[model samples]
Target chain A: MGSSIAANQLVWHHDLTGQVLDPASLNLFWFELTEGAYGQIHRVKAIVEIVDGSAWQLSFNQGEDPMETELPVERWLSGRPDRPSQIEVVAGVDFDPIGVTAACRVAGSPMRYYSIIKPSCGSSHENRGYFLYSWQL
Target chain B: MKIAVISCIHGNYEALNAVLSDIDDHKVEQIYCLGDLVGYGPHPNAVVEMVRSLNIPTVQGCWDEDIIEGLNACECSYPSILAEQRGKLAHTWTDQEIHPETREFLAQLPMTLRVDNLAFVHGSPNNQHEYLLPEIDAFTAMERVLGTGADVLFCGHTHVPYVRDLSDGLVKVQVKRSGVSETATQIHVAPLKRIINAGSVGEPRHGRPNATYVIYDPESAEVKLREVEYDYPKTCAAIIDKGLPAIFAWRLARGLEYAERAEDPTHICER
Candidate 1:
């Protein structure tokens, strides 16, 4: 676990090595969640940029049009029978966790998170891993 | 007899709750599910337990099979890397989160269920992953579903709602978009063979964020395509909270397909 202060907000962080992401591999996802009314969980509204290693980023901004990419991520999200209104990020932030810090707004709000770091398909067998993380406000 | 058919729950408890409540309002005599009880969303165990307590007869979907058999990945047909990536996350999380009893229910689920002249399946009578799309040739579709010898076949996999009538020599098709009134689109089938894609209860792909199912009244010989609105924000939030893919939660509000496919503008019938 690690702690950093940003904009008078004490943000808590965790390195999922050997926990969510395989410690032996050089790939993993870093994500954050926010708590909502009535104890519902949501994604932390923040920008994620990879400073080191390879990172894959997918973002669903709150009140913003979903990005138009090869995949209709927004349309699919809207089409989900559950009808989630909050923004979410899945495996968007993919990178090696040795020196990565995700900038998230962690003041006064509670959130939960889970991520995975596994081997890519059609790739050679390697020491791949899965990882998870949760931060409650 | 009036039978309510639901499919492609994908583990969203809130959506299932709404759909089930709506079904109750309809006062259907029997309820059946077309498989895919878990996948994409959160609350796999909760959904499984509810279905079990209600004792809804269900068929096996590809995701259910993946969880029961401990498969590495779900049989989702997404061509995009991002969708594939998130799908992997959903499968992995759901595989771990499902209750053992849920596993048992999914494990013992039959691939197909026949009731008199109607057949229920997750995808098609032949394969759980096989899609019975609207553009499928009528004869080929007939051959695929004819194995059960049921004149009316109901299946769900594509998450889209459609009805195809292959009676006589003509192939009539009906695809319902979201917001279409339930009464306006009531299907009265003729003596010709028919196939109905019941759509998804947990995840809809018809560009609508409502939970969908089918109400087939044998007494009236009518099929009603019903879409009910649920607390999507609650379910979506639960998905992210459970550490599943955020995309899975985010996509539920839009009600559209995640993957892209080459559009075939022309509808051709194979002889």
Candidate 2:
């Protein structure tokens, strides 16, 4: 039964979001891992262009946080501190209503989700956008 | 002679059974399926076997592709997750339900087929991933149908039946109001390229739970959309017994359509 079943099943996999570390003191980072399996080690970078001409950079490393010294100690040690699985960068832009461009790289793998989050100022008064760039590993 | 095009069984053996019983007497020379022999619905294996027994020319729908090749996993909308979960359940119930032979059969189905100048596609011809509904104007339909080079194109992804005529250089689609009961409906308009959705055989979105099929005669250039009543109780029971999604089975009890919330990306349950 196992052999018959295995023959019919089709295995599917996707790339994980590359690690991005934020050095800003007030920003935050979160990682949402893919469900099933992981692929080869691929490098990814996100260059976030702030409205005020400032920019933030996030990078991925296999066993260490590339921007560990720059991130807030509390958040940097919050989840999976022992082994840096993935990285996320949270930055605040002072520009009242401006857009940020994010570009990610995973070598041969494709980036699944990317977006600029604009937190609400108390009463749902901010606009934001999410874009996904997906490709095979 | 009349030809009924039905696709996307997605399990739901009862619905397929009901539709078949309803059309048992109809003089259908050929019955075409738009793919998705299993998924979401109950009795994936049973539904596949039945469609195969009927000898209908079935195409490989997106849902079918998901099961066999994982083509749209990243893009499978939220409702699709629920639908996929149901498929996985069905897969486990029947010992991985679909066999290699069935998977191969489904894989070989043409994405698009032309019968007497009418092109039949499970989704849209331009992109099998697209869902072309009747609500969109004829211009959108024309744009999608531009290079297909068919007098008529029939699709069934939205599970909603509609007709669009793009002959007079103006695009116009006739939206069949849901819940209108009619034995036979006629579409009287000449079109350079016509778009028609045959609706769903296993699941009908219109308030009435009757399975729907479209009969078109190329020789006479006449088309009629017809609905046949089926055994809803039996279908619903099979769905329930299989421990499928309660909504998946429950929705069939009443012909009310499922509405997907805007925030939800997966709205497969919504008709």
Candidate 3:
């Protein structure tokens, strides 16, 4: 997951190789629900950028909106149906079990969360989603 | 007799107005509502009052039951966790905003209403939350119609409209005794049965923000699906202003379910 970062954003994208995205993982979605339940997965990817002011921003994908991006990381996402609104990252302390922390402000409510290493196992495949830093609340 | 049927009018007074106008154009004698008169939109009481004023024979929907008796049908709400959260928000908003008289009106509605051989129900004969998807097996479809003892069953709840014809139905009965060999008898229904889904009058989910219903002609046995275009943006604005879940507005604008669609078509609603 970290391999796509633009260098200084968090060193080099972590060389966590050959990770296949799970269709049921958490993410934002927009459109008609497919027979598989989740909608079209165009160029959608979870992007959590630790920005200039020691804050991080999360979007399913970086889109036209300059303030916030419309993207989902998994099958389920919280926010507007078409795309998530701009969530102001007010604070990010050193979160445990992962690299960073973040409090996202959505619809005038502060949702505080941090990163965690979620390991999911299946019979035939085991794909890991890792980054230089991931947070959970 | 030509009858007009509507269902899943989740409190959008604007869409209800448009559908009623279209039904008037069809010159139908009777108008039957397949329930879900309230929930997920701006004006619940206004929509109920309109239906009451029109004297539309209505059945109780899952949302109506939830508001009156409480939200117990967890499975009927949504499939996604995020969608479930939004469903709770909408349900809570509706429960808080619903008037006492409107609640009484919804509580008095029957689950199933029959007129001669034509039956009306919100979802299926089994329950309001059970979805009779268009692609369900033929035997199950025939069973739903036969359960009502009706040649034709008119229903809604899936929000997507469809028509299914149950033809060439055969049932075999077998009896076995300890001292006798198994005996079997076959019975067949001569006339083909039909399941007509009225779709949704307010919150539609057929890929467009237009209301849908069905006009049934008893003489010719013809079911015509009607789609009506309304000022949906008005309802969308109301959803945001009413302090309901904002996701409902986005979904409503696109003719999607306010929360989520039915996940399991075969699983009967246990709630």
**lDDT of every predicted structure (CA atoms):** 0.61, 0.52, 0.66
The candidate scoring highest on TM-score is: 3
Per-prediction interface RMSD in Å: 14.4, 15.4, 10.9
Q: Per-residue alpha-carbon lDDT of model 3 for A1-137, expressed as tens digits?
A: 32353422322112111121122122222232111122221122233322111222232333332223433344323221222322211111211112111111111111121112212121111211222222222
Model 2 stretches astray by more than 4 angstroms: A1-137, B79-95, B170-191, B256-271
Ranking 1 against 2 by lDDT, winner: 1
The DockQ of each candidate is 0.04, 0.02, 0.06
Candidate 1 chain B has its poorest 10 consecutive residues by lDDT at B262-271
The lDDT-based order of candidates, best leading, equals 3, 1, 2
- Evaluate candidate 3 and give its CAPRI docking class based on DockQ: incorrect
Q: Rank order by DockQ, top first?
A: 3, 1, 2
lDDT of 1 at A110: 16
Q: Give the number of the best model, judged by DockQ.
A: 3
- Please give, for residues B177-271, the per-residue lDDT of candidate 2 as tens digits: 66965444443343577788877777667767777777777777677777777677777777667665445454555553332211222223211
Cα deviation at B131, candidate 3, in Å, is 0.5
In model 1, the runs with Cα more than 4 Å from the true position are A1-137, B72-76, B169-191, B257-271
Per-model TM-score versus the true fold: 0.61, 0.56, 0.70
